[model samples]
Target: MEDEKNRTGPLMIALQYNDLFDLDSISASTNTEDALPKGRAVAFVKAVQTVNERLVEQNKSESLLFEVILIAKECSEEIKMKIVESVKYYGLEIGKFFFFKKEELINTLQSNKVKLFLSTDRDDVCEALHTGIPAALLYEQSDDHVLSQLKVIFSGDVIGFSEDSLDSLSDFGFSETQIETLKAAKICMKEFAVLIGQMKRRFGQENSPLCICVLTAWGSTNVCVSALKTLREWGLDVDEAFCLAGAPCSPILAVIKPHIIWDGGLHNMRDLSAHS
Candidate 1:
């Protein structure tokens, strides 16, 4: 009974689906090199297998859970078969797999005892961290060093490493321009929050309906138009909307109390609102 009290919980690993198979083909199809290269893939497989083998040697194999997450929207049957074959080659079972579209990875993380997410995509790592899961990058140069880092991360002795950190943002493939835009977005978001707070105070209610104003920068006219269409479809009332194109920025900035000020990336906003 005393030994049981000192035992650690099961270890659950969530691997990126594309990382298990041939990365070259997957990259060509997706137009992204965020897939694990052959050498790195073999190394990761060996590392996981080695850990599990050690567990088995110590009579602790029962405390391991492995899973793969399908981040791609569609994969060919042949490609999938190859993935299965590769997992089999590593002696890892293929029964534990989930499609991102069908299920949220956060759900699995919440239910598991100990969770670690591995992926070549920085966006995936960011998402996992956002949901409070420990994640590691499976880069082309991954080796024993990366594996050792994972062990340290899973041990819960680390903190202050977040998606917003410079290293993490860079790993997620954010360019300097993109990072600047995000910083601006954060300031704008805070402004929106303040505006919303003032509106609530004036209305004397927490659920006051807000009049949102959306403006697009010069190159984002098409995105704003799509957002308008989606907003109309959703029956959301928009007080004002416009594309900056050739217009002076001063006029748009002069607007004092728009509850929510959305600028650029309207297409993504539209899709998110539609789904919600």
Candidate 2:
């Protein structure tokens, strides 16, 4: 069946592995044994439905793969069963859902060829990234946004730009000399870039359901220009680019309401999540 789908066309085929969401991202944190999927559960369901619908509209037979992985220190059978039931109730169609220990996560992810891993927990995200997985810390959304359109925002630092340059840019104080030095630094493609490239390849750049945006802290300075040029040099062009120049991103984020935001540090995610 997979082979048949691949034969349809380049854009019509499914990605080998797409998104993997941690249980915490979909569920509410609680002390109870049966913590059913909550918070972003509905949004996740909508995202899957939208992606499948878009694929069908383009005359594709395969659906975008969405997996829900649970990594627990100790998860009983009853709790696991309850989680399965809750996922069904929420109508979140998962391609592969399983529970694993912390030690088993890297191997599991490798064997499955998971492209992008997302979790609301900082530690889980950090672990995945540390193991060389394309991972991002997802923030919980309470407001209504366009779930059909999966909007993802990435910081310049997350894209593997110069750290020192980004720090200066965020401070709203960067001279031409600093900007030139940043541009001189050899910036290689990071895991996040690889994920973006995969998406672009799977759906074609113009037809992809993803609305990729770059929300850089450089604002509108020359440093911002250099950073953007670096992104292009790395073969990435996002749908939207924001040069905030050290301003609060809450207002801009509230307007865009991206489904996920990727940054270089957990602190960045925490700060954005707090303000968003």
lDDT of all predictions, in order shown?
0.41, 0.52
Off by over 4 Å in 2: 1-37, 61-73, 143-146, 160-208, 218-220, 230-236, 266-276
- What is the C-alpha local distance difference test score of candidate 1? 0.41
- lDDT of each residue in 60-92, candidate 2, tens digit only: 554333344433334667666766666576566
Error of 1 at 174 (Å): 15
Clash-forming residue pairs, model 2: 219-243, 219-245
Candidate 1 lDDT over residue span 1-276, tens digit each: 123324343445566566655555554456332323343444555544554454455454344323333333245665555555555655554445544442465666556522455666666555555454555445444333333211111100011112254233444454664444444433333332332323223322233333345454432445456545544433333456666554554555444222112331221221111110
Looking at candidate 2, what is the lDDT of residue 75?
66
Which candidate number has the best TM-score? 2
Q: Quick one: RMSD of model 2? A: 8.1
Best by lDDT: 2
Once fitted onto the true fold, the runs of candidate 1 whose alpha carbons sit more than 4 angstroms away are: 1-9, 26-39, 60-73, 93-95, 102-114, 142-276
